[model samples]
Target chain A: MEKIKVKNVFKIFGPNPQKIIPLIEKGKSKEEILKETGHGVGVNNANFAVEQGEIFVVMGLSGSGKSTLIRCLNRLIEPTAGEILIDGENIVGCDKDTLLQIRRKKMAMVFQNFALFPHYTVGENVAYGLEVQGEDLETRHKKAYEALELVGLKGYEESYPDQLSGGMQQRVGLARALATDPDILLMDEAFSALDPLIRKEMQDELLVLQARMQKTIIFITHDLDEALKLGDRIAIMKDGVIVQIGTPEEILTHPADDYVRDFVQDVNRVKVLTASAIMKKPDAVVSRKDGNKVAIRKMQEAGISSIFVTDKERHIRGIITIDDAMALLKKGEHSFESIINTEVPTTSPDTSIVDLLPIAVDTKYPIVVVDDDKKMLGIIVRVSVLSGILGEEE
Target chain B: MDKLQIGIYFEALIEWLTNNLEPVFEGLRTGILALIEGFEAFLLFIPSYVLIAILVVLAWKIAGKSIAIFTAVGLLLIDLMWLWPQTMQTLSLVLTSTVIALLMGIPLGIWMSQHDVVDNVTRPILDFMQTMPAFVYLIPAVIFFDLGEVPGAVATVIFAMPPVVRLTNLGIRQVPEDVIEAARSYGATRKQMLIRVQLPLAMSTILAGVNQTIMLALSMVVISAMIGAGGLGEEVLRGVTQMEIGKGFEGGIAVVILAMVLDRITQSLGNTGKTK
Candidate 1:
């Protein structure tokens, strides 16, 4: 279901932003306006919906209205026209009271410059929204404390924004957003101001949070790689319009147009892929004279549903039956390759987790990893793929 | 090379604007006529001078006890030199001018910031205003408003306005673009952004402009006396022309006193805007 929906929003700049955009939208350019009175468009026609619990990234260059688009969602720069529904309630022309209520309870934004009020301590900056929401000092302070801990900035509560490095300041900004326990987090190029190393570190931290808190986020960025890395689904914007929106894989695998394709052309798809690829067919059966105890232990170590046999030189021979291990006795000069079964099971290393599961499930043994070449890399199971995607053991 | 040209003011300037400059001197002939014609030129002087004292207190609050003491000593010197009442009248004239200049200049600056058209149009006017010299400058104020505290203030505003406008506009514009975008995203209403983000961030630069504006206004106090404006400027005028060395010294000292007091207060304010 949609969590935040924006419909036909328009923004224009003039004495009456509300009144002027339509006049301009009706084919009146800024040059024409300057020729007439003055002022021009800040944002034009826009519309989108963000899914609940999904990380939606909006990527754009400077002045592409990516920043303006996100701001419109919060009614920060009230749109000249359109409707905004949060949890199915219309907030398009929401009053200050209702708007503050929505901002306090539902939506929060992390800024590019880390926008921590410089005069405030890091802890206080985190607690600002709560304080604004009229939460008691004790409760907000406690909430702020917990938020800091979540962002791994527990001891930095008393520090000022200037005293910390750029990354640390942004961490405080993140902490401030989380302290409100917001349902939707809007990050506007939040890491763009950070140095590259810190940017990556912050990106990792965001992944960790998304893994746990599962807060639906609408992140704005100019960098396509950042969009690819953070977004479950990315919406590309240009000149105040949504150019394309889809899962990163879909966008990469099948770009909607030349614009989208060119945008993602430089991306390294290999780095984004996984293992469980190019598993070779099980080889002809050869007798495994290895004892039952050794065979059982090997099967258990592989953690595969069943164990496979290979030769001393690491060539697959045939698969061993659990019954074969049970019946087996003392070391009989056994090699797994002798027991290898000739099943030509294979998958690519870049296979996505969603597509990897069935191939792995149907396999009789652990899947082997490989590159574009026929060469074998290693193995992968359902669990490994899940862990890689989920980012942790949990 | 620029330093080599020090201790010079009028000769080169006169040479540069020889013919057009001659008509400007003719305005001095009609100075009395200009004085009679210009009425609004003498705006709110007495009360505004009182306001200046209030500002001094405000500055002292921000700047520290030392500044307050300095201000008192400066005013006392103005009093001791027997130019206290004249200083007050001049103070009134300057106060009126600076306030008007800030009012007109600041909103124009803000307008410049909000639109490309306003900026493009106003920029050249601002440039012209900034470049025109004082002796060369006072002629228009004379022609339009005539000689008096009114014309004097008008002149002072012309001389003193650009820095405040330029600085305040620049200061607001200079705020981190991201910070402004953040404020926008946070749903800050236009008024909220102006009051909170723009003004707070630009306060330092704006304060510098204001400080400069006020000092420039005070410096004009003496020049303005040529048009029948009073204050220590008149005393300096009388002291120099009458060739009373003791009178000149005291009047000069009194002018210094007024400048010291106003300068200290404003400088303190500028520093506080940035420092805190």
Candidate 2:
């Protein structure tokens, strides 16, 4: 299901938005539009859809209209013209009361600067949304504590915002947003204000929380690396227009234009290319019940030193070397499980190449890729990992 | 354009207001007189020693032990100079005018902060109110309310009201944009935004405005006394008229003591608001 659908939204900031919007539509540049009509285009005909539980990232440099676009989704910044559909309801034309209801019930936003009220205690700040919704104090307090616990701020409820560190204050902001339990999360540069180390920690925390919560998140960022790391799909914006949108791998492998290509050229692909992207289908896979002769013959035919052994259900049993398989055949072993080496290094499909570097370097055989259930997926050879880090061949 | 003669139009406008708004002026005069007289009577009802003790304790609670001691000595000195009653009267006037200024100014300031049109309209009017000689307001006040403590308070209120309004508007407007956005994004109503975010954040600035209003009111005391608003200002006026240096010194010292006490108390209040 599409949780959010933004269609042809335009936000022009000036005295006469309607008059200036035609200029925007006529392929006028932002500077030209401003010069001609004394109006600034905030978001020019932006259109996108966020699938349920997906992290859709909008990334651009400052004044690229990324922030304005996110704000428009929730109508925090009113759009000059467009339709924003949440659950098939057009919020663009929603009345003020209905918009307030949507903000309270459907969406919550996290800000970059940790906009926790300075005078409010952490608990009160967390409870603010519920308070505005007219919830009972006791219920809101309990929910606030649970939200705080989710953000790893368990007992700092009584403390003022100024008492906490910057990271902790941002945690409070996140907690406040989460306390409402809204289905859609709008995060506008939520971690850009943190120190680098803290920023990484917060990004990881957000990913962890997302895995558990499964909230549809529309994340805004100026950092390309963050978008690649966090986004299921990324939209690249320039001069108030969305230039390109694709998966991180697609964006990295096939940029739409010189602008996007230049953006990806400087990105560190090692951290972004996952094991799944580079991993090749295993050539020879023998069942544990298969005769040892079959394992050796399969390895020989495939020109490989080793063959992975799996059960009937494709659950990884272990790997067997050609020499071991040959020796087992000579010994007339009925089951290859005896000689199977379960000590072979394995990684998940989602593990990045940067994380697999040491494991890949130390392993003689290709690294086995497995799912959470230990089902064999594919194998990662050193050459494939290297090529994945470098871009795809033309 | 040989001297626009704008004052002639102002005079005509005032005349029209006076004629047409006589009932409104009467109602305002009655309310203000009642409040001032009530406050003065309450202060007089308390024994001087008890009142001093209460003030000392209040100062101690609000500021510190040092300010409390300072207040005690200042009040004692005023009493010893035989100006205690006059000092009480001035306190009443200052308190009355300050209360009225705050009541009117804060909401006006908040309204200005909320609307650009109101801010634009009032900004110049505030400038004129601030810079116009304090004596100029006294003439209209006297004409409207007749020469009394009420007229004095009316004049003082006009003089002192500007800072409160200006500072409140500034404070509310200067509240961090991100903070206001946060409030709005959370579905806070306009009232919720004002009470929960804007006012609390702007509190220190508003308190500073209040402090200025009180100080300005105190400065108007001697000037008000010339219009028959009896207090230490009366003694100062008498001394100036009869050339009694000794009497003038006593009244002047009492006024100085009262000003210090009020200024310290209010300034400390602003500091407290800031820290909180």
Candidate 3:
């Protein structure tokens, strides 16, 4: 079951929001509605489901109501219309007490501004959520320390928010959210305020945390790169409406609209496209079952000078060049090990094409793509690397 | 202009309240009288030397060495002038008025910060409270409680309460928007949000308002004396009416000394939670 499902939620901001819903339903543009009734559309007919343990990112520029949409999930800003179900409980129609309970027990949020209470010490700030839930001082402190240590800030317990650098303050914000041991996290542009290098470090740390925690997260951001890097799936929003929802590769390769296409166009595909994304099925690979004779014949048939050699289990053993195979045959060497070149470059399937460039450039053989156990997955040639950089058509 | 009769209607309103609300006025009068007496007794019970020493140490800790020395010297000068008792009385009155003002003002300010309608309704009233001549409050105060310290305190509270309310409201409202949103997102109930987030954050501003209230309360000391409230104001009034220039100047100096000490101490308190 989905952890959170938002179905046709609408958020209109102004006096008499309910009165303006009919106009939105009639398909009026945001500006037209504003001109007609002076109600600004915050989120227009948003619909999406977040699976448990998934990092579902909602991405848009400022004024796109991505913030509004995330707030709606927790009902920080009440939805003008529609149902939001969290673990099968509809948050939109929940009572105030239940909503508060849900927020206290089920979800926590991290803010873009690192909104640590200025007056609170780092320890106090981190423990604030637990404190709000009426936990005792001992449990709150213990949990707060644990959360701070998780974010690499265990020693900053007594420091004030103003005393810490921006990155450290942001960690305190993250720690505060994590102290409650919530099931879901709503991060609204949570890293947008940091310096670029620190932001990257924080992103990596979050990934590490997510690997351990496996908490479902709804991350909001305007930066496509951040969305692509962190999101399991991304929802692109424009003018308070979701334009498209897809994986990073799908968004890059098959954008649902011109806006999304234009958005993905400037992205550095080399950094985002992985080896598995562009690697091709090896046509002339030889296994131990196939002797040296068959290996040379397969290479010739495929019009290749070299072929990868694998064991019966399809784990990569080595590669053999056409010249080496012929030389071995002439020497009466029946052993495939004698003909195999063990100097073949290999990379994990998850390695980005950018990382593969140096290996692809230096190696004479196509770089072999392998899984964790050295199982041969495919081959990434120089042309495929170039094509991946250009955003693979296949 | 001849037919407005604003004065006549105001007179009728006061008369009606004075007659119909006798028990209410009596209750307020007794309550205020008890509070004033409690503070007065507390202040007077402390030996002049002991009080001065405590204030000096407080100043040193809060404001710095210079303010501490000034406190010691200035307070000693009040004692030297034989104005210690009068100074204590004025201090007690200012303390009582400030305590009462803050008691009502802080919650009102919190309430005002929460709702736009309350903010709007209270804004003009606060403006009127702040801008109306300090002497004007004395009339209602006198009518309600008769001539004594209670009326003087009532007038002083009215005169000094606005700054606390206004600044408290401003302080809470000035708390960062993202911070408030962060509190809300964490499932802070309305009360929790106010206590844990808003109040602590606004404390500095509210302390500043308290400082303003104390200053305004001290400013009203001599005016309150006109309605028979005793203290340094009585001495100043006596000196002035009897043409004793030196005595009046001495009383004025004592009031200034007391004001400076209170101001410096409270000002430092306001600067505590902030970097400043």
- Model 2 C-alpha lDDT per residue in residues A59-81, reported as the tens digit of each score: 99999999999998888899999
Encode model 2's per-residue lDDT on B1-276: one tens digit a residue: 698898888788878888998898889889988888888899888988889999999999998999999999999988888888898999899999999999999999999999999999999999988899988778878878888999999989989999999999999999999999988898999999999899999999999999899989999999999899999999998998899989988999899988888889889998998876
Question: TM-scores across all candidates?
Answer: 0.56, 0.81, 0.81
Per-residue CA lDDT of model 3 for A12-108, tens digit only, reads 9999999888888888999999998999999999999999999999999999999999999998899999999999989888888998899999999
True C-alpha contacts between chains kept, each model in order: 0.26, 0.76, 0.83
Comparing 1 with 2 on DockQ, the higher-scoring candidate is: 2
Q: Please estimate how well model 3 matches the true structure, expressed as its whole-model Cα lDDT.
A: 0.90
Report the lDDT tens digits of candidate 1 across residue range B53-91: 775587568778887777766665565556656766776
- DockQ-derived CAPRI band for the predicted complex in model 1: incorrect
Predicted complex 1: DockQ = 0.16
Off by over 4 Å in 1: A6-49, A59-69, A75-84, A90-105, A116-124, A127-146, A155-159, A222-225, A236-394, B1-174, B223-231, B253-261
- Model 3 chain A is weakest, by summed lDDT over 10 consecutive residues, at A268-277
Return the lDDT, model 3, position A294. 90
